[model samples]
Target: MLTALGLLPLALLGGWSLHAAGDYKEREQERWMLDLARALSSAADAELDGTVATLTTLGSTPALQNGDLPALYAAASTLARAQPDWLGVILTDDSGKILFRTMDSYGAPQTAAPADPDSLNQVLSTHQPVAGRIARGPRGRAAFPVRVPITDAKGKLYTLTAVILPDRMVRLIERQQVPTDAIIAIRDGARATVARSRDQKGRVADAPSKSLVELMRAGPEGIGTAVTTEGQQVATAYTTLSRYGWAVIVGRPTDKLRAAAFERMGVYGIGIALSLLGCFLLASLLANRIVRTIEALQQGAAALGSGAPLTLAPSSIIEIENIGKALEQAEHQRNAQERERAQLLDSLNRALASHQTALADAREAGRAKDEFLAVLGHELRNPLSPIVTSLDLMDFRDEPGNRRERGVMRRQVQHLRRLVDDLLDVSRITSGKLQIDATPVNLADVVRHAVTTSSGQQISMSTPAAVWVMGDGSRLTQVLNNLLSNAERFGSSATQVTLTVDATHARLVVSDNGIGMSEELMARVFEPFQQAPQSLARRTGGLGLGLAIVRKIVELHHGEVTVYSAGAGTGSRFEVTLPLSAAPAPEPCAIAAPHVEGLQLLLVDDNVDAAGAGAALLELLGHEVRVAHNAAEALDAVRQKMPQVAILDIGLPDMDGYALAAAIRHQAGDTPLRLVALTGYGQKEDITRAYEADFDLHLTKPATVADLQRATAPLT
Candidate 1:
């Protein structure tokens, strides 16, 4: 009696499990259908709202307000013609009479036109835009009208109505991202289908089932099992799209689950029957056998499916023993793989963290270096200015006996300036901040000018009246100067440099019969800070940046620089080639120097030496000069006697030249003081800052007499 009871309970439990599985399958299908319905409904709402918004924007156009009926008609026609879904755009009065319609014949009547009375009331009464029911037109045309209320300047409310085509709305529903086999349809308040995913559709009354609408009307969104008029069972769902009584409906066949459940039940029944037969046969042979073993397997499989721990009692059956052991092995391997994957993920996370830290450190280091260079450039340039000014001051004095000494001082200053400039250029180029002003240039003129500026020996050359190329004249001269200086530093007196021009290129060649380059040095010659050898680096008093600067400048001009050499001491050749231009660049006509006695200048600078020396030089050149060491003194002098020209050093103590320029302009409003900013800040940003501060001209420190004369001469 006890054994029979146990067997009966086992059979009942197995049957109940099969029934629950079938119910879950049906629920899954219903959920899917419900989601598809909502998605389709959302797509429909978006399309309607977009059409309404476009028409509202059009109603705001000035053409509608100006009472330009023809212009308004033309614009509305264009809008309607562009959108296939928009039937027409109509303008209506407060009483709902159509004032104009895009569909009307050109030059047609603008009054007595009909509009939907319901839409007009909702728009005027609510004073808000609203979408109304899909209604029939005069010719029995189906369309959805959206009403937008527009208030005029005098607070008169007008109605702008847009008519949307129903068939075109079907296109939006058909393109929705739902099941390919889903039956999608949009319905009106009366449950009439206005659009469908497929061609065959009419009313919810025509949907082969009134129950679909009744099920949907239960709530704003609903899902239910419904029966169609065709006597077919289906999963149906519907969702509300707007305040109006309209919905999107979706249906999927329910028979699929019914057939599937039947098939699954048969399989389950076969498996359970075999278990019962096995138990009875095993019990007849060996009483109460196979029950616990079967139960263990079932429990273990359930735990494994749920990713929970499995514990199985020992079984005498060999097959069950093997299955348990195999399962145990699989669990162990899975645990090992999980551990390995976790370790790998941890390692990857650590590596990513390390890389981010290193990247941040590198960026910080770069920023610190740039700040250091900027500060260093300013500090070095300030002191260098006075030295450079004093050199120019020497030009006016009777110091012929000290001419060689003066020349030496000037050359040393030039060398130091070049070295500092080279370092700054390297920093700028490395940080990608070098700015160059390129223009059409005559290469011959640049060469002559560079030679005049540098201490180059007689260079061999052929005459070309003008070998035109586009380049920065000063930077190109700097490139030539660096090359000549390099050759002079490394080569003997026997060295020769030459310039030649061809049809397509202008070439400058510097051939040196000195210690030529080895293969290694030549390979790395253009690399910054690369010298010929350790011995050469010690012998040459430079950071080996000249060639690098030369190469950079040439590349900026779209030109090329190359080197050729035999083994050490055999002779080396450096060649620079620039592209030629056909058209000649125009040169500015030289302005004649003004008589200094006719000029009055104000010199404002906190640097005592720079201010006094510059003023003395200007006075020596016959200009009436006034000097002030601070802005207070400068302002007092300006107030006492406003000078025609003010040369203000930007790095003043109390106020910067920019602020002083503004103050001066305020003090002498519209009197046209020729403000000139002379400062150590010569970068592009500094020059732009000067202009924004109201300076008429910006000159870098250590300006030649020619620059100041030319600048001040014009004012006189």
Candidate 2:
């Protein structure tokens, strides 16, 4: 009786444990199958979303907006060629008349209408993209259409469709690598199989089993037993995509799952039988010893609870001995856990302190960097201002035999100024402070201005009358100059520039027969500081930031720039595409030039050289000029005789330019004096401050004769 009693609980425990293990394995398998179904559903959604995006982009193309069927066909053909799974691209009117198809030759008559007219109608009605049902494509294969609606400026609607092959979706299923006998399938909203992993020969575009359809109708996702189209019973897990009314079903054969469970149960049964037999035999022998051993174990447990050392002697039974050993180990683990927790707390404290310190250091470093850039710009421009003034002075003189020297000096000075501007622009770009002063700008005028200012090999140009785009004209000019400069530096003998316009976009292409880039250089060409390999001499001098700036500025204008090169020694081509804007009213004929010469002016700069050279340049320009080295001197001069204009430097030895300007305004209460801020600070904030301080104009250091003349011109 005692042996049986002891063996009974052991038998029950073995059975319970085996049942729990089986249940756990089954639950885990179900969870995995459900997860797989969700993953497959997500993949299908991504594919459909990608097709829709492509169609949307194509719908916005300039050729389509302008109703240029041939150009639209060509563009669509190029896109279709890039995607192997794309059967063709189609365009249709709101009434479903096929305008063009990439599968057909350009301008070829198309008799067949779009494969899915209902989806096209839906898109036209909703003004939203749609994923159409699988149907017989133009190629007489199973395909589906993704449609996006395009509306012209006059609100006329058109549809753009991309016919996609179903085989690509089957490829998506194959990539999941489901079990050999398992079934993975994607079904469209109409309960037809779009793609299947198994028995796909005649299964695609065919309806799934009635039972699976019933399960799909029950919910967006669920797990249940269903029969597949192949007449095989399966444990099916399914999920439906939210974006498109589609379903992804993963079905594992029920027979296989059952076989696995039964096999595990059989193994557990045999083990349990053997264990019961062994326990029956041992129970007889161990029952008598168990009571005494249990008493000793109880004592050890009490001692352990009291935090006292275990003092139990060795026992004949292995389990009793193990119990004593466990008690001792438990005491040791307690001490170790306390020590580990203390160390962990200390580590966390140190880490938190370090993080705070690093954050403060980072903020301080940023502040210091900003200060350094400002100071660097100030120091660099101070010297260039005097140089620019001297160059202007030379321009006024008709000195013989000095034209070449004068040209050399002027070019170098302009180059230095560009470098400074590029440096400052980079800072603004990184800090996200750069802004575009958008206005209707004519590309023809921009190209002309850039060509005249660019000093290099004569550039061949071809442009239409006027291609208007909303952007900053000066920034656009900078983009062109950078491209021209890049060509010149790379040894281009012949450079050609072409501007092509359409109703919605303008494309500017600059091609040069230069030292073309290698594949490695092209890969990272737009990254800042990326440059071609140079010798020690480094004849091509640049900071390698020109292309980087070009890309950023173009992006600001909602445009794109790309570079293409046919390997080294071949050539390189750069293309910039910007969205077109409606041309503004024709600018009024140029106003008569302002009489800027022979005026009374006051030039103030803390740098004596800058002030003196500026004064000399004004005097040479047939103007009465007075120079001041400080704000106090400027005020004194203004008090003595109120000049027509006062050009004050922001950085002064006395009160700063803003305060001095206020004082001067107070002194000349009624005098209409124009205050032009001529300083090295050229940031956006500095310009804003100039206006706020009542300054009529703001010009950075190194202002050219044209810039100075414009600033000194009477405000209109």
Candidate 3:
């Protein structure tokens, strides 16, 4: 409302300015027309004065009574020639006859006696000057007349002269100021238009009838307003020519003023609309600033609640600036709180780190304990292998119909052998020695081989035929065999087992429909020496290292192993995913043989019994064998004999196997001898040490006769 109120004065002033300016221009136009009419009337007056002087001179001539009419006509022609402005000159006697005359340039007589002699007699009889506007008449009509009387020396009137007045006055009235759609009229006393700016049909309907007459009679100039025939308002002004009883009118349409007012109003409206729009925009911008500042504060609060970093509010005005300052103070407080929280977290992390280190150390010590047990198991199994082999031989010697006790002993010895092997594998894995002979292998073939070796009543192979992986083929086979054996032992001989292989991984899923483990037991099933239950122990009569070793081998292969079960009675699934290798190496290549023909060999053992037995075995395989009981003795023998092969034992009395190999190579002058490390401690770092000592082969104790023989084979 205030904005509208302010704009009202500006709108009115603009309209007034336009109206005043339009009126000034209208008045200027009217004055210009008046000046133009006065100029035309001045030109007409000069023309009329010259004609009257020429006519008066001709009328008072003495040639009027002379009998020589030709001489009198010549005298009149002379006078007409002297005043070129006259139409012609005429000389008349007191009788008002055309006694002498000079014709116009067109050869028409300027004055002729009227058809009514009384017309000329009346003019002469009055004996006064008679003048009016004149027009050429009909044939035999009196010539256009402006008559003057002639006087003799006695001061009495004798003759009358007539002259014609042209259409100059009417032409002057025609050239007046008038606007479009407006009429300018000059009327006589009878209200008939004597002169008009337009045709009669274009005159205004309410034009003043009496005002035009009064203008001619009572006033020199007057102005009036009226509505035109076109239904537009007009202003009419008239000025009288007092000498001729004539009036000149000037008129203009009022629409010019209306148009100017409308244009001014339009301009005002546009300006007002723009001003309001600007105000609205300013208001909106101010509101947005406040809202955005509030939004920033809200966002900051939300960030604080969600534990994200908070920022201060935006400030675009005084109120918002104050709010922003407050927010900044709060943000500073939050920062201090965050610093306190960070300190608390740091203290907790430090405590956790200390506990974690202690826990790690304890776990390492427990792993060492499991490794020691596994090594003890391997030591126990070495003696038991021969016992078990001998028992098998004894069982074979007895016939199937005889010796039932021998068969029982053979089966029991084999079970003991398996338990000892599992314990040894656990030891090897824990001690970080579990060496893998990686090979590019068709997992399908390995699965099939494991299935063939297992004694499961039902086994199903679902793996693709050509999915290849890199691993020790023999180790993978053992892993699968263990899983199958466990399934058969725990689930029942009637349980089915599955093996699957894909491009990226190989899965061995061994499920048992028979009594499965509870969740608690399944969780710990892969732990060494763990079993399902005390009651199932008899049904599955063995050490529980099978699944443990399976898990260990899969871990070594960088694979994952998981078990799933519904509960105790619903069965379980053990899934193993071993990554496929891009290229596989050879596998078990030396496991099947310990020698080739004519291969020179050396045997080193701290135990005399093992040394003699190993040398004898190498000789039996048709290779020359040298025996050394310690590292120093082996180095002496290499300096003397420079043997093509050296078998070094780690448990030597003087020096270990790896040290002995290094010494022998140094003394042998870099000769290309095949060195084999034969040690009971077959940890991964032990083999690496043997390689550093320039041994070509590393073999753990209980390496088969065939493996040792193959190690000594000639490189070519």
Candidate 4:
């Protein structure tokens, strides 16, 4: 009678276990479907985000910013060719007039408007990117546009759009490993199908069934039963992308899901029935023995819980013995895991310490490098000052026979100066301290100045009367000179430079017929230390920083530069485009040397060569000059003879130029002394400091005769 009573409870427990198994299976399937929906939603968002980013980058191009439709068309064509999933790229005015399309050739008239004008209007109103609804695109294929706004140089609004084919989204959905019978679809905000796992191309743009639409409207994400467009009822899981209001729906047929649950329940029921029957038979045969074994197991389990060693006696039943063995193995594993965790923690601490140490070392190394570059620039500029002064003096003398020699010497000096300047500019650019002064500048003047500075090259020039742009004149001239010098260094004897102006942009092209760069060399040509291969002599000598500086400067001015070559020995071409400015070009003025002569001046420099050369040049320019080698000498000269002007070098042996200037002022209490600071420190901070020290003028080293004439002109 006791066995019969126990069998009744066992049967009840088996029935409960079967029901629980079926419930668990259904819940598990629902969770899996939800996870799959979330994954698909994330994938779709990523793809759309990529398209938006690409459109943003394209809109920022100088061609688009300057309203150069042909250039923009070319760029769009290249981009479309590169991306197979892009159906076309179009640029339109705010009124939906298509200005250019990649599907059409350059300058081709396009009358067809975009399929989705609401998205373009949204972009224009918000000035942000928008992903449009799927529709029949211009080519009669179903696609969507990813649109971004572009404000041109004149502040006119335009929309740049990339039409994306639905196949990409279809591929994204198909890549997910889902059940064969499952249905997956991505729907736009309007409930139109964008992509579906089954017959995507055919079902695209179709409206979802009423039931599915109701389910989607219920919440941002949920699981429910809905009838698909195909009239099949499914258990659907959906998640909405927050950015674009798109939905990723994953569903399995309701009948199939129910069938799976029922199958699991049946298997569980059969297993439970067999287990109950076996237990009953065992109870009938050996109930007393089983009872004793159960009591022993209870004791052993309690002992293991209390951290006591397990001790189980031999049992006739193999399953009971195996259970005891498993308990013992669990204890061993716990202890082993504790030891392993401690070791792993120690290793992680050591690795973290090492990483911190490496990071500190790298920072220290960067500081040291910056300091070295500063000191090197100062040291190199001191010698060049004397050389440049001497060259100017030679020109002033106009010795008849040495014209060619003087020209050669001047060119070499200028080259060395440029190299030093490039090094300093690189340091500034790396530290994010390089700055430009923007004003209305003419490209014709820039070309003339650059050609004069880069004299030896046979450059063919073509430019309009005036092409105005907004940038730093000196920096723009530097950019052109670098290109000219690069061509001369790498090209054959002949180089050509051309300047063309459109309505909103100016194009500067420099071409050279020399040994062209290989594809590998061209890839990294703008990197700081990248250079083409050189022979043992290295006839073309440079630190390989010119082009890097060019790129940085051009970008700072909101411009673009590119290089092209067909192949080796086929020549090379470089193009630079900058937005045009409406500001009119300034009238040209001829600056002749000031008529100041025979003014009493004191020149102070620690370097004897620099001071002597400078004094000689001043004397040749018809000025009476006294040379001083230190601040004390300068002060003494001021006391002995109150000069009209004092050219002070910042770095001196006894005292700096700032203090010396103050002393000289005190010595000549009421007399006006024009203080000119001529030093190798040309950084912006240094210039600011010089002005703060009551100096009348500040000139960097290697000043030309023209610079000196202007400085002394005020004194006269």
**Tens-digit lDDT track for model 4 on 685-707?**
89999999999899998888988
In terms of lDDT, which candidate is strongest? 4
Preferred candidate (lDDT higher): 1 or 3? 1
Ranking according to lDDT, highest score first: 4, 2, 1, 3
Better of 2 and 3 by TM-score: 2
lDDT (Cα, tens digit) per residue for candidate 1, span 398-458 = 5889889898998888888887788778777777777789778887887777766666354
Query: Per-residue lDDT for 76-110 in model 3, tens only?
Result: 66665664334455556665556544664323464
- Candidates by TM-score, descending order: 2, 4, 1, 3
TM-score of each: 0.47, 0.48, 0.41, 0.48
Q: By TM-score, how accurate is candidate 2?
A: 0.48
- Output the worst ten-in-a-row residue range by lDDT, candidate 3: 134-143
Q: What is the C-alpha RMSD of each candidate to the true structure, in Å?
A: 31.7, 35.7, 51.9, 37.6
- Please identify model 3 stretches exceeding 4 Å from their true place: 1-368, 374-440, 455-462, 470-475, 501-506, 513-515, 535-542, 555-559, 565-572, 578-595, 632-642, 670-672
Residue-wise C-alpha lDDT for candidate 2, range 98-124, written one tens digit per residue: 888888786787786567667888888
Task: Estimate the overall C-alpha local distance difference test score of candidate 4.
Answer: 0.86
lDDT at residue 255 of model 1 (Cα atoms): 72
Candidate 1 residue pairs that clash: 208-229
- Total backbone collisions for each predicted model: 1, 0, 13, 0
Give all candidates' CA lDDT scores. 0.77, 0.84, 0.64, 0.86
